[model samples]
Target chain A: MPIHYPNGRRFHETNTKKRSPAPKKISYSNRGMTLEEDLNETNRYYLEHGLAVIHKKPTPVQIVSVDYPKRSAAVIKEAYFKQASTTDFNGVYQGKYIDFEAKETKNKTSFPLSNFHDHQVVHMQKVIEQNGISFVILRFTQTEEIYLLDSRFLISYYQNMDTTRKSIRKSDIEKNGHLIKMGFHPRVDYLKIVDSVYFSN
Target chain B: MPIHYPNGRRFHETNTKKRSPAPKKISYSNRGMTLEEDLNETNRYYLEHGLAVIHKKPTPVQIVSVDYPKRSAAVIKEAYFKQASTTDFNGVYQGKYIDFEAKETKNKTSFPLSNFHDHQVVHMQKVIEQNGISFVILRFTQTEEIYLLDSRFLISYYQNMDTTRKSIRKSDIEKNGHLIKMGFHPRVDYLKIVDSVYFSN
Candidate 1:
């Protein structure tokens, strides 16, 4: 796959079109912290700056037993997921509701739709019908590259997985997604994209 | 504590409220489940009908340990809540972002703000600032009367706690809240209130 760059150059995942090497290595020894920790820290920065209001939807759980050991608290003795969620995080930004699913891809060539579940696809469909901005945040774990792909592109590709190409190529993602630049305060400044979409009219 | 109808009749808890009569038989017999069970059943009905999308917020827990038996699901080992949440159920209805806290009060006289947490109050304030509609679903556990009290009212009363009132009086709630007629399905049809607020032109 290829994407037309501003200089009229066709960029490909092959050796001919490699993205510039990542700027630098992060100093923090985040050996065990999952990508979720870094993103949450970044989201906190965005919230403090009034940039966006996003929250990781809590994993839905069905509690079978709760023990009230004391009056002050109730301990969940047993629980399980009642239903799968549509996305990891969602919130309102610039008067428009925003929803998204985030996935980490280890593949070097492309991201597989197998990372997503059917219920998530259905949930995104409902969000789009309700006029909410919906998308998928794909992180290439090895390269640490993150891109926001609109749901329109995602669902289309997801549905055509069987007969179509193996996965979405790097070149195609660069064309459709707004690349999220990693930063110091908030690693992923996603609200900037939300501002560009909803407020920059 | 009272609400007057247009016919100049007063509606008080004593007359309109009906206690879910305690099982006359022994606990060893088929005593059935708690009020929580009935409400859970009702929420299931609502979800099946697409009337609303509300879910019980999972209890925040601190996980310390887990045992991974081969070929079995990963069990939570140990965990604790990082912090308390403000409300119980939050979701979308008729394009209106709705957030709410639910509490069960055995006190037939009134519901107490002590049932709410400081963190929850702060969360509600933030939710309102972000253009989301928020309220509390108060269940008179014995009487089964559920009232939807706007967060605005709750916030005002909360702030005035040190000065004038310590609790939101039952009379004030009756005056402002929209009474939900309990049913078997969708136990609490809160979308009816959302429709009135967001869709009534």
Candidate 2:
């Protein structure tokens, strides 16, 4: 039977289960998690441990058509992805509003400016103006190095891209951003940087 | 050509334009908007005027398969809706974290507890524990009346529902919750209630 939410939207538990397929044989050498997966695990750790209440917003989808069978769950037959109007992750932590975007780049020398969208940058600016904690988590995939850069620096660099360098140099990020150490329990472990940068008096 | 976001997801502006089809002939007397639509417009108004920063989280959808046509946008071929793990609307207001769920009911005597889910109640509890503002906006459609009820009252009522009452009485809501007067510009105008209930220091 189709399970319908209070708002009349149908849900299927099977689809959620199918979202993560069966795990393959473990190989430590080749196995690696994407930045999104790492952040998701970190956020889940925060939530389960009663530390924070952050969550990644679902990818926006412009749903077109739906199929309603007599006895089966409603299936979405047609849809297309939509551009998000704000950052991907946000929540409340220690009486503070937290909002941020995470991105991973393969380039070793610098992070490409094209990784961010104009609307996302503007959204981060608005978040900062509202006195929320706003920043970006950047990971260099090749070096396995991650940094939490303040949105102010990002916005400044993004705005000056035409005049200055097209991409932010690794040295500039190292100077302005805080390096995040990967951990066992919470993989990304970004709250430490947030505490030191935004909360430390 | 299909417009692709930096994350490689395809987007089509036409899809968004299609999401809201051409507005039907205006029926001033009979036209009524859903609570979700009202809140959306209200949030937009707040954002534009820089009064507050809030947004409704996108509906969660589990994508099963996608088809990338040679010269067209990537179409979601198979997908299913998933139950959201938290409240629908959340953001920052005057440097404070804000979170809430909104529901409308036709019940004249009482507000049905069925409108809320267990996870949402728990999420609200977590938000309050983090010192974030949490509440519920409920509408009695029969009388076109709305109230903003604190989540603490809601949680208590929900917990003892089996013994005391299956639903919260309208009289109880009238006494405990703040009545939100509908308005022309923002429609619901629930922020006035938030300011009075939460920030009246």
Candidate 3:
């Protein structure tokens, strides 16, 4: 069996064992964390703290061939990536069906609508129809700002994109979206925003 | 870039095109349907009919190497399967979170507990703790009987395996579990059982 980092990097326990241990470095700011990594860490924190049960769905792959060796594990010989049919992360949060996709863009002013595929948008719509708490975690990488925007707003914007701007303006996001505060323990505390935005009475 | 059947079989468009056109085979009575195939078909039906939004999570894989050629899609050079930490199927139905794992056993007398992993059992416990509906779909292939057993019962049976029987008896399941009726459109009408067991007053 193999383990992978949240960024899809392969983890090598043997390599780690061969290296000389060094003191861990501490950082005050969210400098090198990718949105996926932050979310995975946050979900792990939530799971460990008994706050939520969320997981990033595995990358969809279309396996073409596999080799079953004489005395070893079956090895995937040929495979290709498949476009996901649904959002990346989903699970139960406070007895509610929580579903969302996380995306990051380098744009400073607007988040491009092209970042999401049609199927994902449609899937989010369906989840919302089923009364699931559906949203998107958008990160403006240029400014290191993250926002949780409801899927309802995204779907409405996506549907009317032919006449309007191809991207969502930052001002609109700031007004409509909830900012996710960065933290050390969980890294991206989006659920805190979720509680206020979706759960607050 | 490639398509796949519910059984993880690769779909070859070229091969399919080259084959002589033949009428599709028709069958009844759930003669050869695996539990996974049934669940996948049922989920597709639910999705298409706007009934619910359930999906089987993709098998987790850890890619060790990738070959990105100048042209064409990148192929996975080396990859290994990773053990899943959560149940296979999950989504929202009628404003409720639904999570379950489907399994089929060849044994006629009892359903073995070894079919589930400790992590999966723990995950189901967590789901139940969070007030999410959790269960397992057990199929006795010998008799073609399918039962939807709640996670609470399964967890208790699993945890007390040391002192009691290592498997749940067929009679016990017949008494405690709700039978899932076979169908044509959705194949296995498990949600009907879900509604009666988890939703109905």
Candidate 4:
């Protein structure tokens, strides 16, 4: 006997219920995985390869109420997500402090300044003042392009937003920012760009 | 009319809540605040005075379910506390990466190894291998003494735990670690010890 699904697909009467193999030319980039997931995978690869030690800060949540239904485990009953005070990703790389925020925009021509918060811009400035490397990873999702924009340039643009344009043009980013080439194992090899830009003698 | 307690003590009629402007003999070290609260206050002071930027990472929680009863807010109905992958406090100071785990013990003689997890030790090792400064802030609550113990000594001790004692003795900590003097504005001035140990020329 064969078990039939709603689409009239039947499972063969076998001990191992194996499905058909996946297509050989499947593109992982377009497989609906979120940008954060890709970055997490990249970080894991970096950690395993002993290249760098970086991690995304866990999302902060304000717990309001809890229920201790059993003595062993406590259950959170009510909580709300809290705004993060600093950038998402941070770690040590080659004896230098690395801190950055990642954002993806579907726009084609410009990267909006509204994607960044005032506190985050201020935090990045502090990191730069301390001589630590700080930058933003902006992904133009429509074109599948990513650029690492230094905080120094970002701060100048942020401070002059009252007089200048509210967003940075794609042409300016193409000129100033380091384009990160997509990779298979690490996904986003941003550290390679960091080495060339910040550590190059 | 005033509210009275079950023991017939009137709230407004009591003079226990009143305090006199007394002599400067009170010691903040003996105050009822927990070690975590004091560290949080110290970090806040550091941030406000432009000294160092450090923060205690929030408690991690694994959210199992959420209820979107309204469009305005998503209420967390069930969640469990998750063990943190990295140490609690991490930040940059003077272009150097700083990472550490803080622990307070009620035991008078030694700090127990059971307080630390295997993964935290591994994480600290990775931080040190990358040339970042890593350590543990151990506070003996009974004696109100705090010491910054470097990860090198910690890793050595952790490795030989099977043959050696299960805890780091107070004498060992006093000899190997830097004693952090308690302060007024910043309760625990651990960065002063960091400056002397890692940055002093």
Query: Highest TM-score among the candidates is held by which one?
Result: 3
Error of 3 at A168 (Å): 0.8
lDDT of 1 by residue, B1-201 (tens): 112212222221121111223322222211222334344455556555665444454444444444445665444433333355546566555555667777766667767878788878877777778787778878766666778788988888887787545677777889988787766455566667767855689
Which docking class does model 4 fall in? acceptable
Question: Which digits, one per residue and each the tens of the lDDT, describe model 1 over residues A1-201?
Answer: 123212222111122111223333332333323355556666667666765566766554444444445434444455333345557777656445677888776677798887788888877776676667788888887778888888988888888787567588888888988888877667678777767755587
- Total clashes in model 2, counting residue pairs 3 or more apart in sequence or in different chains: 0
Model 4 Cα lDDT, one tens digit per residue, A69-144: 6336667777766667788889999778899999877789999998888988988988887788999999887777
Q: Considering only chain A, what is the TM-score of each predicted structure?
A: 0.77, 0.84, 0.85, 0.83
Worst 10 residues of 3 chain A by lDDT: A12-21
Residue B143 local lDDT, model 1: 62
Query: Compared with the true structure, what per-residue lDDT tens digits does model 4 show for residues B105-163?
Result: 88899889887888899999999988899999998887899899998988888888874
Q: Which portions of model 1 miss their true places by more than 4 Å?
A: A1-33, A60-83, A163-166, A198-201, B1-52, B80-83, B163-165
Q: Give a tens-digit lDDT track for model 3, residues B94-182.
A: 87889999988878999999889999999999999888999999998877888999999899999989756799999999999999887
Task: Supply the global lDDT for candidate 4.
Answer: 0.76
Q: Rank the candidates by DockQ, best first.
A: 3, 2, 4, 1
What proportion of the real contacts between chains A and B does each prediction keep?
Answer: 0.07, 0.60, 0.56, 0.52
Sort all candidates by lDDT, best to worst. 2, 3, 4, 1
Q: Which residue runs does candidate 4 get wrong by more than 4 Å?
A: A1-29, A163-165, B1-29
Minimal lDDT window, size 10, model 1 chain A: A10-19
Chain B TM-score for candidate 1: 0.74
Q: Give the winner by DockQ.
A: 3
TM-score, every prediction: 0.75, 0.86, 0.87, 0.84
